[model samples]
Target: MSTEEPATPQLQSTVSKPPKVFSCVLCAQRKVKCDRKQPCSNCIKAGVSCTPGAPPKPRSRRRRVIETDVAARLQRYEELLRRHGIKLDELDDPVISARPGVASASVDGANSSHISAVVGKDGLPLYAPNNLWSTLSDEILDASSDDERDLAIRVANQSLDSEPSTPPKIELELFDLDTPLPDLSSLHPEPLQIFRLWQTFLDNVHPLTKLIHAPSIQQEISRASGSPQTFTKPMHALMFSIYSCSIASMRDEDCMEILGEDRALAHRRFAGIAKKALTVAGLLTTRDTMVLQAFVLFLLSIRNVYDAQDLWILTGVAVRLTERLGLNHEPLLDSLSVFNAEYGRRIVWQIAILDGHTAGRARIDTSRTLYRGDTKFPLNVNDADLDINMRERPQEHPGVTEMVFCLIRCEFGSQLHNQAAIEGNNMLRLLGNPSTPVAEKETFISKLERIFEEKYVKHCDPAIPLQLLAMVMVKVMFGRLRLAARHPRRFRDRGATMSQEEKDSLFAICLMMIEYDNQGHRLPGMHKFMWHVKANFQLDAFVYILNELRHSSVGDRADQAWREILECFEHHSDVLTDTKNPLHVAIGNLALKSWGARESMLAHLGQTLPDGEVPRPISVLRSQRSVGVSPGSYSSVSDQRVAGEPTQNQAFQVANPTPFDSMDSTPIDWEYWNELINASGIMIDETQYQQPVYDARAMNDWK
Candidate 1:
């Protein structure tokens, strides 16, 4: 072509297209521009040839179809649900979790799969490519053999079982997790005695606690009693705990009559054995649920002997252990037998109540778990109704069942616990927070009372011992809470504005607490719970009445209050004659001062107490202090007073101030007061009543 152009003279008229060119090789290698000359400017600078290169291949753009993907997924789900006979439109119904006609959870019977279905976040599973369990399970499910498929289904149904994760072997040897247990034959009571203890537990502890499945455990206890050598560690711990609780619940005279053994000696013996059994059972680390049950039972039995503060801390550990076992969550119970699941619920509920009670006793904040626990209350059913072999949960009883006592208590406890956990539940909290209208508090309390009455107390048959206990206990708690809601300190931070009517109401409520407790002690049917009643009788109510009588002038309500007080004191005369601890002596001294005031007022009014006679408590206290001895008083408690009489004056006065005495003008020491109450072996209740939010104002002026 060049030659022809040069010769152009012979010009062929047709022109040929030149070959297309892009960046030069040298420019391309340097990622620089090429001028299209055979040797580009960059190449010329480097004194190298610029080789031409082809253009880059075009990149294809991908179109995003997020809406299309979502639609497809939704369609796929709808089709799947349709094929499974699910009503997609009904998916949003509120009652789906608790559909009609389904039985509630049961502790005794095995639970069959529910006919109603619930969708779960994890239902549409997408197994990872390398997940070994998922792959193996899928293979098993796909197997042609019916045995393999059945086995796979069975394994899948056990939702309680976590996926097996292969962990690195721990070959290091330092301590023995499975140490050889000591010979426990001696700890095992005789077979006949075991039956007796079992019966006692069923009669006394089971009705209130309802923690044990009586029928299932009865057989185990019978076998274990005769053959201690055959006992598992957890069951062994449980058996000993049962014996300890039984003996602890019995009175000394009852123990002597029934077992021909001293109650105190038998309790100490069995309780010590129970401690050993818990240690052997590995409660802190064991995954077995019975170990926790045994631990809780042991705590309950030792309540009278154990320090409240330490017990509270120990229950904190129990609560942490409960969380470790995932008991506070409900869905984790999926696939478990109805008996096991319901018992698990019972265990956690009991632990919660114990934790709350101990915290109340210690006058401290309750466990935080109370605020957030989602575990449902135990189904209202009897011990005989729950069976390990049952396929479905039994229907909840409409009337009373073995669990009725626990159910009612659990409901009230859970609500109050959660309420106090967030908003300060006590009136004393007004010191810090803007006070809630007092009327609002009364409204809430009245509503609570009505709900409690209609829902629980209405169904109770007072003729039945357990039902009567429930009714009385609920009313007492309501009364106590009502008093707390209307405390004098809440009227004004310093109580200057407390009306006489409210003061009278408070006095009446305090007296009522003592009266109910006295009644609990008096009733022959309530004899089993007498120990509990006596131990938990609050000092607050006692101290309040004494303080009110001493510090405030009486109104028209005083006569009735005085009569009730003396009557209650007469019923609980055991306190005056039983001990001389500071709390008790303070009671003695305050009553003395309060009685003096009452007499003066009576003289001024030309009247006298009930029969113009010295009350039993006042008479007994005066006689004890004057003579330095009283009837049946040389026991462990009152003996301390008689022994230390010389070092301290027998005459009680402001020299030894009590919790109600602020004569020194010093700030109130709640901690010291709590210690005094604890030392006196009085188990206080938390219920937002004790552990009052201290006010740093002028409340120290005790009158």
Candidate 2:
């Protein structure tokens, strides 16, 4: 018990102790256990650049020692089990669920192998590579915002209408008076052949009648697997072919082809094609397609292949696309500006003149001297001049009517801005003529007036104000208001030589537009409409209309137009009222009031109105008297109509009420007024319609 063991002394090593190994950065940052399997356990744990400490030399399991005791026991057990009733192959292999947190135990532990990677929802192998799978997963999981969707749509839109690999071939058909002559003056026989080929091409294509019924081929191509640009190509090509056909129709198609072919019937065939093509092309909302179509239309117009109608249709296509896609885009405006500047004004004027011709119920004399090249007011036509009679004589041309229709469609229905400027002036110039005949002038003025007061007022946006003003000016010119007010001395000095009725009429028209404000008289839509009209039609035509209305002479178109307008207004007074157009109603009432007051004109107006109801002008005056008065005062009061009213010559004085007299009159009596006030109530104003006449005048002066 007391014996002690000998103590051993500590031995010092010559080398210093080895430094501690650090974990790999990845594992250390995460504070997770690492295999440390690379160069060292620490390196594997950190997920750092790990390399095998040495080459991965395969180990021979065969060389390892066998557990003979366990092996012998297992083999003996298996042999005894097999004799009892069990087979070694009968045991089923174990499987693990794909979901994590499943059982770890496996029945076949004797045979172990690593599991294969998993597949993802999008059918891609998600577990194959860590780097690639994460990116794919993030994209698949993230939702797209509204702006992203729009961006994608825009990207698709921008790609449509790229030029085809082939040089965009076209086959133009010719019909009687339809084919377009090559710009080259040289006559050729091949053009006719080309025209026939164009017709044949259209028949084969079986052009679309409506956009909703796009051909099966076209629909299929758009949906095919290709870029949007490629998809829209067939449509664009079809449209171009149609345009070519329209151009051909204008040529002398019936003229024997250089090869002796009669292609007069080609026009109808090609027109059909053009219509279908336009319908298909319009389905596209992409910027590139819109611009291309606009450019093509412009070229056709300049080349005289397409008339005003064609230009109008083409313009509609461009404007609709631009609006649908959003006009703020730079390319759209750039293209529109070019089209607007080049022939824009001319097209507008043409439409205005067309409106004048048909609505005014007069022959629009394009032959009248718009200008003489040597004169200060040059009668020269601009490049934009789409005048139907520019190179032709005064012979009645059927094309003139067509051209007018074209102008109307283009200006009124398509490019509204152009229509406002041109159509307004053309209407006024035609209506203001002294010799225009009252019947014709009245019809024209009435139609023109409705478009502004009724149509434009309700839809005030766009260039409606300009249109409204134009209508107003034409109305005044028909009545000779501007000329009489500005140059009263001319009427007084030449009273005996010229027609006094014509002078008086012009003055009356002017008075209606020149409302008493803080300032002197002014013309509505005059400056702006004139600016555009003068830029295209003969500048003097505008000045001349004013001058003619002022001077009053025999055979004066202004005089003729004034009479025509008054007569028509008297005829359609009731129908005009339903329009609920304030301007039209006001003018109608004034015209009727003047006529009913005159013994001579009363008979004329009586014949115009429905079976004997007092004219509106007389009715309005009576209403004003009883506006706020007793109810019984609303009676017909036939007594006042018979005695108080002045004759036709004196009738004009109502509009010329002295400033003091007008101020003395009380505001309209709302209670006593029934039908008159009722009519006014139904009228919807396009503009605020609240500015005092003076304010509009001041702005006019400043301008």
Query: Model 2, stretches more than 4 Å misplaced?
Result: 1-278, 284-320, 324-655, 658-703
Tell me how far the alpha carbon of residue 303 in candidate 2 is from the true structure, in angstroms, after superposition.
30
Per-candidate TM equals 0.62, 0.22
lDDT tens per residue, model 2, 1-703: 2233222121223244454445544555456665654465666444566532223358844311134224423533553444354434444534323444322212221211112123322233322211000101111101133343232222222322442111121232211222322211121114344444434323321121111112333344335323323434334444344334333433243234422434434443434444344434433543443333333332232222223222333433443443454342333333554333223323222322332222111111212311111101001122223232344312333222212212222223222222224456333333333334555545544454455345323433324333343343333332332332222222212223334354344334433333211011134423322222211221111222222322221122222324433333333333233222222332333333233323232342343233245444345433432222222222222222222222343323423421110110112111111112212222111011111111121122111
Per-residue lDDT of 541-639 in model 1, one digit per residue for the tens?
776776565443244344444666677777566657543233555466556655665555555556655576776678886765452322222112111
Q: List the residue pairs that clash in candidate 1.
A: 25-51, 107-339, 108-386, 108-387, 109-387, 110-390, 111-338, 111-391, 112-391, 360-686
What RMSD does each model have against the real structure?
A: 29.5, 34.4
lDDT of 1: 0.58
Stretches of candidate 1 off by over 4 Å are 1-181, 367-372, 417-434, 491-494, 551-560, 570-574, 578-580, 602-613, 627-675, 678-703
- Candidate 2 RMSD computed on C-alpha atoms after optimal superposition onto the true structure: 34.4
Local accuracy by lDDT, each model: 0.58, 0.30
